[model samples]
Target: MALATLGVVVPGIAAFYEFVVKGRKRLGYRVQMDTTATNVVETDDPGVFDQLREPLVDPTLVLLRIENNGQTHIDEDDYAVLHDKKAGVTITFPDRKVVGMVVTELSDDGMRSSFEDGGGLAVKGSRILLPKVPMNRGAHYKVLAALDTMNGKMDQYPPPKVACTIKGGVTGGKIQETRSRTGTPKRVIALIVFLVAIVVAQLVVFTQSNNGAPLDCASGHLNVTGSTAFAPIAREAAKSYQDLCPDATFGFDMRGSGEGLQFLDQAGRDGKADGQLTFSDGEKPDDMPGLLPRPIAFFLFTLVVNKDSGVADLTGDQIERIYQGKITNWRAVGGNDLAIRLISRNPGSGTRNAFQRRVLGGVREPGTNSDDCRNRDPGSPPGVVRCARDSTDAVLRTVESTPGAMGYSELGAATGRAGLTAIRIDGHPATVDEADHGAYPFWETEFGYTAGEPAANSLAASFLRYLTNQVGADIIRSYGDRPCAELANPQLCRPT
Candidate 1:
């Protein structure tokens, strides 16, 4: 029995040695190195690794069939690939040392069998396999392999070391060339769009700035139109105001007072005029629209004659008779025997309205041959030796130069002229003090009109306010006109 047990043990030991050791010797393996197309390869003058050192590397998967060059069969389940870091790996070379081999695994049925490079159990009729590895262009890599048996026996073999240089940094070079050719057009388009955006933003800012101070008038012009009699006074006030507000501009035009009302109407419809001046003929005209009534000064319409004429005063009835052609000769009104030359404003003038209302009782019919003694009509009239002047200046000149002539003008123009004398009206002297106190009977107010609310309170409005103030009253008095108290507040002009 002892002899039989010894025989069984010996056979078992002998079988294990043959299958695990001798069988593994027949399987030979080696490693190969290749360079990628994109990177440069540099090596030290002296070798950096010995044949006995284990190769350290980053191994990429490859797809290839490894033919069984010896008589062995490789198993599929006996291997794995490992890395210093499991997910991905990097290999660093210090001082550009010469590289040995990059380690990788081999498999029997296209699957890795062990972590060692070129490791596999092979049969003479079978082959091992690997998957392809990808690399950067011009990059160099080293590779090696090893073999192992399941029973702990292992062997490593070094393949011939070879060197190769990559010709170009292929991927990086292509990217740089593409950028160089296409950059200018894109940059120009971007710059144009940026500039356009900047201009639009600046315009928006300018508009907002103007909107904040629309009424300041620091950079604008204002225009006033209407009553010729009021034109000089308004112009003087505007000039004085301009001295205080240098950035503001002002202008005026004298059409007749009726036309002034029409201009007010037009301003209401189209925003044309900034102000209007008209005489009060007892009531405001219902036909005029959008008028903003404000009293700026008082004008007394007095009959003026050449200083050489002997006439100094006329009763209301005498003046009516003269305008009606009842008293054509100057001798009738205590003047020279010369013919009484009449200078009158145009028919549409508010001055004409005021004259007719006060003296002729609104009678305006033209006399027949300066002999008709009746007030036939109040809208049309004739005078002997009529000088049809549209403005106060013309009326004054006609009265001053013509012998035995009489015409009406505001007190301002009637005074200080060498050749004209103002006549007394209804036993009351036509004086600025009388007009200011309302005792002179021809006091009236002026107005400015606008459409709805103005776009904003404007410089024109400021000027109007100034014209009503005390300083403005002094200016008015200087011009031979009464201050605006009677027109502004009749109560203020009541007798003391």
Candidate 2:
């Protein structure tokens, strides 16, 4: 009888440790500071109000910190409130009315837009409402609001209360008060607790594990198409995903981003959108109705030149002048005296769009005048010869073999090619860290677009989930791209 009891209780404890203790997702909050306006007014001091407005009555200010103090990410869908109840979280001040509010601080500057109007931030009577803001692990923001008495009485009221009423998904939906930290000690404590829990759990139970299999796996044939810049990542990720799910298969159509999106648009119209998807170096066109975009990563691009050119860095002005047909020779830009050859991509390429938007300052590149990338076409007035390539690999190859040739390619694709150098812009190297800090300018948010939202259990959705998860993030980072999941400013992943 005692053995039977131990068997059941031990398994229950192990299950609890696995799901509740180790893998739990939590959202925590803390009221760091609260003060009433009346407390600061002295006997003879003027009240806290402008002459143009009514004087504040028992007006108070609150500093509230909300964070994803969880082991996993909290996505926008995780917020239980949706449809009719649009606010994700609600803060109530009993007997008080909210006058104004502002976001005081954030873990990432990318979060700033979330607090603006139309982001679902609203004030009604005594309640402050917030939109369904997605937060990565340890991401946080602070809200500062001014509150006044609703009944015009100067009497003190009860403290404010936060109710995380919309609890849905795997996350611990409710936001509860937690201890405020001013430094890194909170991380230290969390680490120590995690270590202790792991040791104790191992000692108490011998549990069977699934050997690191994916929890979300769907089997189906999916068609993928997209930017040549992003094709390598898509192919590699698809192969790995197939390894895990034997029944799943993927077909690729390596076309430019615009072409892929066009295909997806037609697929939607034909009722075959569920099994088709495309990846782009940037956002798809607005005219492609019914397409849903999921951000993937921040991909960096670089200007590559043949080593014989001897040019290491070019300023933004020089680049613009080059594309503008003003600078024609390598010697004009501090390089060897070789005639410049410009290798460009077709207009349909998303890489070309990003290059024009980010590096060319919203200007279009001059039309291709050379078919072979070696000589200009008849009747084309030229100082430098220019041509277009259909794929990233072709661009790299062309730049490598032609002296004084210059072209742009995805950072990963340009890293180790022979006879070519990945030149920097304004002396800043193409790196994720540099791009995140505004030092590098040739980066764009990568996106995955579908005709419509795939069913939760469909292969299209599961493959996307895999690309954004930890395993996929590791793969993405290995190729010199920064996955959206790890961005401090997640908003950067959203196409502008």
How accurate locally, in lDDT, is each candidate? 0.49, 0.79
Regions of model 2 farther than 4 Å from truth:
1-213
Candidate 2 local lDDT, 118-150, one digit each (tens): 456777778989777778889999777677688
Model 1, position 145, has a per-residue lDDT of: 21
Clashes of each: 29, 0
Q: Indicate the residue-level lDDT of 57 in model 1.
A: 31
Instruction: Go through the candidates in order and give the C-alpha RMSD of each one to the true structure.
Output: 44.6, 22.5
TM-score for candidate 1, residues paired by index: 0.49
Q: Please estimate how well model 2 matches the true structure, expressed as its whole-model Cα lDDT.
A: 0.79
Please state the error at residue 35 of candidate 2 in Å. 55
Q: Ten residues in a row with the worst lDDT in model 1?
A: 171-180
TM-score winner: 2
1-496, model 1: which lDDT tens digit per residue?
9999999999998766655533421212222221211113454441221111332232111111122222233222211223111111122221122221222223332333232222222111111222122222222122222111222222322222211111112211100100112222445434433443343334335446645332333335776766777777777877776665677786666677777666666766775554333332223477654554555555566778887778887787788888777887878778888777777887767777777765677688452332121222344555465545778888888778777778887777677888998888767787656655555655444444443444344665666656665345556666666545534455433322
